[model samples]
Structures are given as C-alpha cells and as structure tokens.
Target: MAPVTSGSTRTRSTASHPGHPDLAAYRARELGRVRFRRALTLLVMTLLMPGSAQLVMGRKQVGRLAVRVWLACVGSALLLAAVGWLWPEVLFRLAADTTVLAVLRTGLTVLAIGWTLLLIDAWRLGDPLRLRQKQRLAMVGLNGTVVFAVAGSLLFASHLVAVQRDFITTMFGDGVASAAEHGRYNVLLIGGDAGDGRWGLRTDSMTVASIDEETGRTILFGLPRNMTNFPFPEGSELAAEFPDGYDCETCTLNSLATWAADHRDLFKGSETPGIDATIEGIEGITGLKINYYTLVNMEGFKSLVTAMGGLTLNVRDRIPIGVPVVDYIEPGVRRLNGFQTLWFARSRESADDYSRMARQKCVMSAMLQQLSPQTVLTKFEALADASTHLIETDLPASEVGEFTQLALRAKSQKVGTVSFVPPAINTSDPDIDKIRTMIDDAITKSEQPSGSGRKKGPGFSKSSSGASTGGSIGSLSSGYAANQSADLSKVC
Candidate 1:
C-alpha cells in the first residue's frame, strides 16, 4: 500500500487518526460547549420548577419530595384566597386570632429556610467544578441573587406578622363581652385630661355612640361638660349617693370623674372607677344602656394624629394655639399637624365651651373620612404603638374583629349627631325627657333607609341673626353645624 497510495487517501487517513493534534483539539472544543449547555439548562430548570434540576441530575428522591411540597403550598394558597373572597369576615377573624398568627409566622419562617436550601442544592447539582471559569462565576451570581430575593421576602412577611401579633396582644385585653341592647351598641367615648393636682382625669368631651348592630348606622349623642342635674341609673352607686340628681352648684357632669376617683369605694374592685361612674350617668341621661366605654388621653391623642400623618380640616375661624393666644391656626380649609389639630379641638380662647365642642366634632369627622386603608398599611406600626398609649377601653379583644368590620361599613354611610347645647336644652338643668326623646328620634332616623323618609340634618346653616363662633360654621346659641348634623362630612 505504501508503494502507490494517492495524496487524497493519505490526507483522509491522517484526519481520522486519534493521535492527530488537530482532531484532539476539535473534540476538546465540542466537549467544553456541551458542558456549558448542561450547566445553563440545570440553572433554568431550578428557576422554573424548584426541584427539576436535582431530578434530572441524579437526586430523584429529594427532587420528588420538593416538587410535591411546592405543589401543596400553591394549592393551599389558592384555596385560602378563594375562601377569603367569598367570606371576608372569616379572613378578619383569622387575622385577629393570636394562635393563627403565630402559626402563620412559623410557617413563613420554615418556608423561607426550605426554599433557600433547595436553591443552593440546585446550584450544587450543576457541577460547577467542571464548568469554565466564566460559566461558574455567572451561575454563582444568579443563584445567590434568587436565593436572597425569595428568602428575604418571606422573612419580611414573617416579621410583619409578628409585629401584628404583638400589637394585638399588648393593646387589647381579655375583658368580658357585653351583649348588644335593642339591636344596637351604645359606647361611651370620653376625651379626658389629667392636669397637675387633678385627682383623676376631667372629661372635656363626652359622646354616646349608638350603633346599629347589623347595619353599623351610627348616631352620636354629645353631652356638654357643664351640664348639671343629670340623673344616674336607678341601681348604680352614684344614684344612691344622690337620689334626686347631681344638683349641687359644683357638681357638673365633668366633675363626676374626679368625684368617683376620690371615692373609689363606691366602685369596688373597679380598675376605672371614673369611667364606670360616667357610664352610669350617661345611661340615665340618654336612656340607653351602655355596652362599653373608651377613654382617650388628650396628650396621647397628639401622638396618634402625628402617626396618621396629620389631618385635613376646614378651619372656619382663627383658633388660638394656647391660652393668652401665643399662636393662631388661621381660618381656611387647611392641613393641620398634630400640635395644630390639638389646639383646634381644645382651644376656647375668645370662644365658648360649646364652640370648642363643635370644633371637636369636626376633627372627629375629618379623621374618620380621611383615614384610608392605604394609609393604615403604610403607617401600621406607628399607629399600633400610638393606639396602645392613646386609648383605654373595656371593649373585649374578641369583639375587635367584629367592630373592625363594622367601622368599615360605617365609613360608607352618613353619621347623625345630636348635641345637648344651648337653645336645644339648658345646661344648668337639662330636660331629661327632651334629651332622651331627641336621642331616640336620631337613632330611629339613622336606622331608616337612606331615602325612605329619612330627614337630613341642619348642616352648615349660617345663623340668620347670630354670628359664627369659635371657628365653627354656626354659633353656640344657634347650635354648631358639626355638633348636630345628620351628615358630619357635609358640615365639617
């Protein structure tokens, strides 16, 4: 064969030989390309289907277990979403339950850890040691990024869940539940201040919020601080002390708190004697059985408003910031900070107590209307912290979920109000019969359908003869618009 071999035949033989340098180089290049493709495929599979990479790369048992768990988690999430959409109250109840929250937090933590380990295993299955330097570096970067992102999100969610649990446990207590009376819940709201030398808090503002149990329709019965000669419930300790009524010259409605505090023996074993006594007096005056009481600390209220990022109010007149008029909140529709709002609600400079009460009503309306869900989520932590200090209540923690749902329902409807001020009733000696009649009528009207003979309140009507007082739309003599309006939003 060597004697007469053709040149073309010789060349072909050389190319086919395993020992040839050119052939060896070409095979090496092909092998490198295959390894790179394999590495890329494994990473992509792990990203799309968490355990797929391990299944294909020889960890069948681990891969099967992970895939099954992932499917179960997805299915459970879909199921929960479906149930929540159908029954919103169920979700609220679950959210308010401490045990459920603790379970959720633990589940989230476990999920985060499990997901991270799976991602790391997927990277290991890619065989980084055999990959080219550039390919190995790229895979490591991508894998780390995904692991941190997923794990970080889950951990953050767990933290928020823990925060909510803590807030609920700390702020609310295991108080006895009070049943609704006559298809309604009458809650007493007291705005109090404990200044120097005060025996206890003096209630500057008081309102009985009578709400429909089913509809959440509300009517606010505002009691003046200067009101006198109001009766207490027949069987209450206060009534035994003053059989006729609280008729002494200095025995105004506001003084009851101090008196109750000084003589706590009357309210034996009671943590809040002042509030208990006030509730009894309110029940007799309004002829409604009070279900619960919420006392708001005036100083702590500033912190709450600040946490909410201030409130927008219609400033009808210039309000002095402090006594002797150091500074003034000028009139106009304006956004007021916590300090300014406190002054707006509390200031009585050049303004009577009735005028101050009117301003307080406006502030309450503005807070309710402006507090949106988005704001709550954004400032949830601050709001929770402030609320614990701001409010003291006998409302049961178990009822929080229900009341929360009710409050949301109330936001959509008009709020009716009836204040016992000036021309309506004499503060020195209020007509108990007339006051009760007004409260009954207001509640009856509020319970009616929106347009079914439901009369609207006298809202923001200028006094034809009297002038505006204390930055309110109406005068004390004519009745402040915000104090007795059917729709508080319209007047405020």
Candidate 2:
C-alpha cells in the first residue's frame, strides 16, 4: 500500500491545472487555508454572538453556560432600559443608593474579566500556527484591543460612581431638614466675609430663592446689606433679643450676623446662631418663610466661580478692583477670574451698594442660565471641591435628590427676581403687608401657563452716535424695584 506522491501517479489528477501545484503540496496548502478561514469565522462569531464559537468548537457545557449568562445580561439590560424610560425616578433612586452603585461597579468589573478571558481562550482555539503571519498578528492585536477597551471603560465608570458617592457623603452629611414651607422651598443664599473684621462675619450678599415645589419656577428676592430697621420673626430667639427691631446705630442688615454671634447666649440651643438670626431678618422682610440657608464664604467663593471656568458678564462700566489694589476693570464683555468676579459682584465703592445688587442679580441669573449639565459634569471634580468648602448649608442629605430634580427642572425656565433695594419700598420702613403682596404677585406671574422665556440681561444699548450707552447693572442708578418684573434677566 504505497502512497501516490505525484499528479501523474494519482488517478484523474490534471497536470496543467492552474488550481493545482504539486498534488500533495497543493492539497495540504488548501487545508491550511481552510483552517485559517474557519478560525477567523469562529473568532468573529464569538465577538458578536458570544458562545457561538464554543458551540461550534464542541465545548457544549461551556457554550450553554455562556449563552445563558449572555441572555440574562441582555434581558436585565432591556428591563432596566424600559423602567428608566417609563419611570426615571426609579432609576434616580437606585443610583442614589451607595449599595446599588457598589454592586453595579463590582458586577461590571467581574463581567469585563470574564469576557476578556473568554475572548483570549477563543483566540487560542483559533490555532495561530495554521494562520499566516499577518493573520496571527491581526488576531493578537484585535484581542488585546477588545480586552483593554472593555476593562478600561468598566474601570472608569466605577471610578465615577465612587466619586459621586464620596461627594454625597462629605457635602450633604446627615443634616436635619425643616419642612418645606407654603408648597415651596425657600433657601437663603448668604455671601459672607468672615475676615473683613469690621463687623464679625458680615453677610454682605443675601438673596432668598423661593422655588416652586412642582413647577420648579424660582423667584429671587435680593435684600441690600445696608438695609436697616427690619423686624425679626415674632417670638423667635432673635425677636426676644432685638425686641424693637434691628435698628441700632451702625446696625446695618449685614451686621445682624455679628450681633447674633456676639450674643449667642441669647439664641440658646441654636448651633449656627448667626445664620439663624439672619434668616429671621430675611423672613421678616420678604414675608417668605425660609426653610434652609447656605452661607458662602466670600474668600472661598472665588474658587467656585473659577471651577465653573468663570462666567461671562456684559460689563458696562470701568469697574475698579477695589481694596489693596486700586486697578480698574476697563469693561466690555470680559471673562473674569475669581478675584475680579468677586469684586464685580461685591464692589459698590465705585458706584453704590444699590447698583452692585443689580450686578449681583445679573451674575446669579448668568449662573442659572449658563451652568448647564454638560458643563458641570465635565468640570465636576473642580466644582465639587470648590462647592464643599464654599457652601455652608442646613439642607439635609435625604432631600438632596429631590432638590436636584427640582433644580434640573428650574434650569429650563427663566429665573425671576425682586430686589427690595432703595426708593422702591424703603427697607428702613418697609410695609410688611406690601412685601408679602409683592411676593404673592411675583409667584402668580411666574405660575402663568403661557410662561415667558428668559429675557437677555439688561442688554447693552447704544446712543444715537452708536457709542455704547451701557446698561444699569454696573451703573449708579435706582436699583431694580421689588416685584418690578417677572423676569430678572430683562431687568439686569
């Protein structure tokens, strides 16, 4: 039984066939080519349709297990997609839970590992010796790429989840909340200068943001720091201390915190006596109940603005970088750094406090308008770090999710403002009833069905000569009248 070695010796073999070289050599080469093709086909099948390669490779048990797991993962993903689409809050709640996030991160890591191993095994089964040099190199490169891409993406996602959890724990803590008042949440925003030394812990900037619980429409009421003769909340610790209203000489609105701090014994059992007393004054004047307060340190406040990559302001005048350095901020549309921005918001020595309040409101409106979700997420770490140091709040951790949802809704709507400064309604002798009526009317206007879109902030105007007339924000003019307009963007 001698084997035939040549085409002439082999039966029915064509000698001049283009498809045939030497009979035995050509047949062996053809088998090698077939093996290479099969290896590629199996690799592609496993990549796209997991477990298919194993089934074809006769690893029935491994194939069945892989197939079942793959099917379950797909089913779970589809179910989540459906729930997320229909009821997004369920997803939000689940995401907010640290335990859920931890499990998700762990599961992703494990899946990445398992998938990478399966892919490597599939590449080994491809039998690289039978492949051409180029084909073998391609297989190795492709396998390495898939492994890194999957594992790297999973690891990055897990890091983000961890960052968010850490942020939640540190910033929100375990604060106890006061009930939401009048179907709304009113948070007092205080920009305080603790280092000024003139009046201890003076809250130079104060604004009450009254947010509608359902609609998310917000009304910002600005109270001047120079405001005097305002009543305190009746029967509260502050009222008992300053019975005849806060009307002492040099007892400006900003000084209330210092007074409360100095006489903290009078506030008995209050943790942040200064803040609590300040809230009383604000509530009494606006006639809007204050639910919580966040005192932003003026020094650290610059870091926060920097973190947002600075805000754009249509600067109308040559604002001075007052105190310590007497340089001027020659104005146009300027992107200001932290120090320049703080001065722009708080500087009144150049003009007056009343005028600066309008500028502050403009800055506030700009933040609400420009601080989009995409921007925040991109600069997340910087913003998160800056915020933790800058903001001192009584807002509870549990309500953080609810407020976040509300804020997201608010972003799509125009922010309305009422500045109770100067000749509008004298803060020195403000009519409480009138203030309440103003707040009520603003709320009504904001709740209108045909909601007005955001108006451009006191836009720059030009004189007949085409020279810039400039707006009132950075100018010394009668500041924005309280309840003057439903949209502060227009009045800035």
Candidate 3:
C-alpha cells in the first residue's frame, strides 16, 4: 500500500529465494557435495572393478590401458596355474630361472605400488573436504587395510614359491629320470643307517612303490633285508658282477650298500654306486624296472617324522623302543612321536624283521594320508629343512612337477601293497618265478577299477588263487591283515 522509495528499497537477491545466501556460495556448496559423492562412487567402482574409476572418470585413455593390463594379468595367472597342473615341467623350468624370479619380485612390487596409488587417487577424486572428518578417516583406514592385505598376500605367495622352488632345485638338481616302464613308475625306497658302530651306509629297509601313471593306483613290493637268491636285472652292472644272484650268506638284500661302497670300481661312473647297485638287485627281485631311488637317513628319520607332527598308528601290540630305554608304544589308536615312531617302524627285537616290515608299511600309509597341503604350507620351512638332511633321491628336479601331480592323484585312491615275506613266500629261498607272478598279478588287478571282479575293495582278487589275499595272511599271530591290502587305511 505504501509508495516505493529509493532510500528504503526492498531488493530480490535470487529467483529461488530472497534474503538467502548468494548464488555463488550456494553453487560452491552444491559442487562440494557432488564431488564428495563422486569420490565415494569412484572408490566403490575401483574396488569392485579395478581401473573402472579411471575408465569412466579421471582419464579415459589411462583407464583403458589399465583395464587391458589388468585383464592380461588375470589371463596369464590362470594360464600359468593350468600349465602347472597339467605339465609341471613348465613350472619347474620357470622356477629354475633366476631372471623369472627377479621379474616376479619386481612385478609384484610395481603392482602393489601402482594399485595403492590408484585406490588413493580414486579417494582423492572424491573430494574429501565435502565429507565429514570421520568419513574421510574411515575411508583412509579401509583403503590402507585393503592395500596392506593385497600387497602382503602377493609378497608372501611369491616368497613361498621361491622357497619351494629352491628346495626342489637343491634336493633334486639335474638328474635325468628314466621313462615309465609298462605304464608304471617304480621308485625304490631305502632306509639307510650310518651312525656310530654301524657298518657304512647299511640299508635296513627296502620297498618298491610301483605307481600306475594313469590311475595312480600303487603296488608296494616289500623286499626283506634277509632275502637271498634274488637275481639282478640282466646286463646290469650288478648282474654282471654277481652271475648267480647276490648270494653272499652274510650279505643279503640289506647288505648291497656295504658291498657297493666297497666295490665302487665295479660301478664305474656311478654317483651313488651303493644305491644304484641296490636298485638293480631290487629290480631283479620284483621283476620290475626301477625308475628312481630315495635313500632316507634312519637317524634323521626321527626328525622327519617330528617335522610332520608325528604319525597316528593302530598299534597291534606292545612295541619296544629298544635297549637302554625299554619304552613300549601301547596298543589301540595312538599317536607316536619321533623316537617312538622310529621304533614302531624299525624295532625288531621282540618281533622279527617280517613283523617290522608290516609295521613300516602301515607307517608309510599314515604319512601318505596325513601330509595334506595345509600341513605342508603350515610346516613348509620345517619340512623343507628336514628333507634336506633326511632324504637323498635320484628323482630329477624337472620331473618333480609330474610326480607331484601323480602323488596328488594317488592320495585320493586306495593303495595296494604286496609284501613278499613270510607265509606268502619263503624269504630265505624265495621262488623267483612266484615273486614275479605275485607282482604281475597285483599290478594287473590294480589296473582294473574298484568292484570289478578282478579288484575288490582294496584287497586281492577272489579269482586270482595265488594272489596274497587277506584270509591267507591270517596264518601269522597278528595276521598280515594291515599291510598286504590295497587299502592300508582300512586294515591299519
């Protein structure tokens, strides 16, 4: 109603509202809020899809390059893993390369740095001043944690790979492995003792682990230390030396090491003359070609078992540790420590060597079942260190990958065993023909799938009359029930 006057004029500031903040100030506040939201969105995007933030926001060109590199990294990793599983030779060769290891260390470092920077940059693009102080700190803490976890995981994995590679390289070196014979890889396992008062490197235990390459089903041919008249493979150096089998009355199956050590000249150009000669003798006994040999130190065997966290054995009877300390591992489902386990597998005072052999087989089965991947990873360093002193093998580093794959496969199936001792055959004068027949039949039956008329549930075939059946083995007191079955776990 009052007339407008210049002195007392009423002025409108913005179209939206009068007497409010200036347009510029309001615009600034809105921009701040929008930027904070963008920053939040950018972080979430980067976390979900690496490089996506740069792809959609900051720099299109950089985002595209980052995306491509990320894809390549993923693809290459998957390919390497697949190859490692299929043909471990590739992995073995790569592991042997110092240059590759350096590259891996450097690449992981670069990725860790670059990844962290990108994540931090994504948060920076979010424009933190717009966010509350608490929100900004929270983001910083979360991103820091993520960076540490990712980087640490990559670095640790790299270190483990290197350690395992070094162990394989140092242990196996460059020895060439023999080809699989008749679709099988037969490795000679020898337990050697060279402590004080003992003859030089006398082999106390011998077992042939013959694995089928395809199915991974195994047949363990146990040769007694007292076995005599076992013929050597024809044309082999040992055979040429001992024309009528290794028939020294005092020097039987376990005496090969001392003899070979004494006559290294006979085994010319042999790195491990003792082990090689012993292998030839085993080949003769089992009628199977020996692919490789593993010599385990008996004294150090305790440390090896301890490193594996001990073994669980179904003790059939009271077993003595030995002379000075007459410690007996009592019966029932029990866990045995290093000292106790060694005696359980090797002691022969109360019982003869034949009984010791069966107990050893059960010990082997327990070790095979318990050495899982988790156990290896957790005790990786200990196991590797133990092996350096405890085991000596002719297995090649290059072929380790293949055998590793085979071993992994073997873990899932039933293990078949044929101990050529006692009631099954006469050890003092074993029928060489019958020994060969037993091994051949075991292998043949193993090749057939489970429940096939030829192969029952981890036991000898009902059809094969001469086969080492569980029923026939009952002639003994404890009964050779535990060791002579295809399924050692069930009997043990």
Candidate 4:
C-alpha cells in the first residue's frame, strides 16, 4: 500500500522515529488516532457532563443514567434555590460557616487530584478510550473503587475537623480557664428539659461526670435536683476563696439554681462567684472535688440532635407527646427528631423522674453514636450554625477536638451509667450520710484502673416499699448496657 501523507493535524515524534520514510504514514495514522481520541475524550466529557451521557454513549434508548444525573443536578439546584429563597439563612450560614467551608475545600481538593490523574493518563495513553470492552469494564471497576476510597477518606477527615471545631468554639471561646488544684477535678454534664417550657425548670437532669487521668477511669454520679444543699457553690465553705453573697441554707439542692438565679449579680464577674462558686457549692454538698463544669442550656441539646440527624431511643413505655396529647409513642426502640428526643428525656409526667433520667442517658449515648463522617458531611452547615448559639463549655477550643477524638476512639468500649437514686434518701432525710457514702464508694471504684475490663465496686440493694435496701452501689466495667442495673438500694 502507498504511504499516506500527514493530514491537517500535528504529530509528536518518539525517540526511535528520526528519519523513517514511512514517517508520513506514521503521521497520518497518528493523526487519525488523535482525531479518534479527541472525539472519545469529548464523548467521555459529554457523557459525564450531567445531561449528555445517553447521546454520547449511544444509549439514547436507555437514557436513565443521563436522566439520573440531570435529575440530581436539577434537584440540587432546586434545593439550593429554595434554600436561598425561603430559608436564606442556609445560604448565609454556608458562607459564614467555617466548618462547611473547610469540608467543601477538602472535597474540592480531592476532586482536583482525581481530575489531575485522569489528565495525565490521557496524555500518556494518547487514546483514553483505546481499551477493549473487557479492559474497559475492568478499568471502570478499578477507577470506581479508587474514587470511592479517596472520597471516603477525605470525607472522614473533614468530619473530624468540623466536629472538633464546633466543640471547641462552643466551649472555650477565647478565654482560658485556670486548671484546678491536683486531685480535685470537676466535670459537669447538664441535661436540660428546655423544650417543655416549664416555668422555673431546675436542672431537669444532672450528672457530675469525673475523670481521673491517673486511673484512666470515668465516673458519672447522678445528682437529684431536690437534694438539700447550699444553692450556689460560693455561698458555702467550699467556696470560701470566692465571695459568698447568696444564702441557700434552707433550700434543696435542686432549688439552689433558683436561689442562684435570684442572686445572679453576685456571681457574674470573674472575682465574684460565677461557675467557680457554683462548682464549690457542689463540691461541698457531695464532698467530691469538681474541677470542670459543662452546662448545656436547653438550646445545645436541641441543636446537637438536629446536627446528628436526630437520634434513636428505646421507648421504655407508651407516652403521649405534644400539647393536647396530639402525638403518642409505643414502647420499643425508635428514632426521634430533636424535639421528640428532648421531650422524651425531659418528660416526668408520663413516667417516674428516675425513668426519665435513664432516658436522658440513653439520649446522650444515641446522640454520640449517630455521629459519623456521612452525618457530619450532610449536616456540617447545620452543626456550624448551631455551635455558635447552643453550647457553652469551659474547655479550650483546641482541646475540644482531642476530647472528641478520645470519645470517638472509645466508641466501642462500654459506658457505665448510674443515677444517684436511693430509697434510703427522701425529702425527710436531712442527713444523707448513706447516700454520700454510696457516691464516694462508686467514685473510688470508677477512679481505679480498670482490669479485665471490669470496675470494682460494691453491690446495691433495691429498696422495698420505700425502705432502704442497705446495699452498696454496684461496679461496672466497659461495654455494659446503659440500662444495666446493679440494685444499689441494698444499703442505707
């Protein structure tokens, strides 16, 4: 056959081709290949261009893929447009939301890297579509696997960053809290029933969560709202270092909040009794040192669930919800929205307050469990928005990430939960020596380094007909169910 001359296209030479007579034929063949490749590249680009897949891939009769992409783009645009039109805060929030921006930035980086690799392959192969049907199938599978892996990794990293940032910003804005003295650390986890709009709502739920780094064990001591003690920490002897302005001598432990609210001015400034004084009062009452306190005032609870795509709860009993008893729930495990879960944890009318407290712990566990990379990616904007207004923590922002990482790592470990409810103590029991002893014993066990995945502690007896069971609080190790009961009522 006669050698064909080079057509209109330009061709690059390899190291071996210097002055071959068939260079014209080679150039022509190369031009034809270039034309085919350019056509194929355009076809691939169009196939992935969100609306031309059917036409480019000769699947006009089966345009589902193209239709799907078009629908996705359309849906996304409509959703964004609706958000921009109706709830414009979503848009404004995305703009100001640092967490959202960080996620977007990381995602774009990954996409850029993948596109770069694709371009390099096209340059070397000279014909991206040169693969036979079998090879193309294999390439598709391989490329898909790699793309998913990279996307998943980037997504997980972005989520961690956002969660940590939200936790940090909510806790320690810019101020630093001086760490307390040695062997005296206080951590408070406050559960509020804010959604119900109850007037003068005392802490709906309270747990003095303490961690002894030396022993590497965590202790969560439940505190009833009604335990009689000084209202604010600074007012008691424990708060002697701080100013003592309010007097809660006759008030119950729960009513201390009321008294503190009444004497708000006395606790506002740094020199005055603020959180420090409150912590002092708790220490004096429980005889347990408190070094840190975390208060989630109603709003935080709602925002957190909303950020977490809501939560799932094991409904202990059928309960009516909403005003006028419009909504009802059957007893079983079920998922709940932010408002529903908040109400479930805070409800005291349907069941005994003790049961409500248990539900509160369940809500907390479920909330933490639901958090993952996908959830964070979807709700990053919502979380970023909620973080600014909902939470209040004393921990430094930088440390918040570390704390969350710790919690995430410990996700598989069992968490022990105990409430400070004993029939031995009642409204009439002014001397809570037995209750205090139980708390102290439990704290000691929790502080001990866990061995064999078991915490050492005393057994608890259940009170029969309001009589003290006289049993010591029970001990638990990691991986125990949240509802696991060890009858601590035996003693009194």
- List runs of model 1 lying over 4 Å from the truth: 1-53, 129-138, 194-200, 451-467
lDDT of 1 at 41: 81
- Model 2 residue 333 CA deviation (Å) reads 3.6
lDDT of 4 at 223: 65
Score residue 24 of candidate 4 by CA lDDT: 65
* Residue 218 of model 3, lDDT score: 73
Q: After superposition, how far is residue 194 of candidate 3 from its true place, in Å?
A: 6.2
User: By TM-score, who's the top model here?
Assistant: 1
Candidate 1's residue-wise lDDT over 394-416, tens digit each? Answer: 77668888887777667777877
What is the number of residue pairs that collide in model 3?
1
Tell me the lDDT of candidate 1.
0.81
lDDT of 4 by residue, 358-394 (tens): 5566555555446764786677777766755655566
**Full ranking by TM-score:** 1, 2, 3, 4
Evaluated against the true structure, the overall lDDT of model 4 is: 0.51
Highest lDDT scorer: 1
Model 2 misplacement above 4 A: 1-77, 129-133, 176-178, 194-200, 267-270, 325-330, 334-340, 451-477, 481-484
Give the TM-score (vs. native) of candidate 3.
0.79
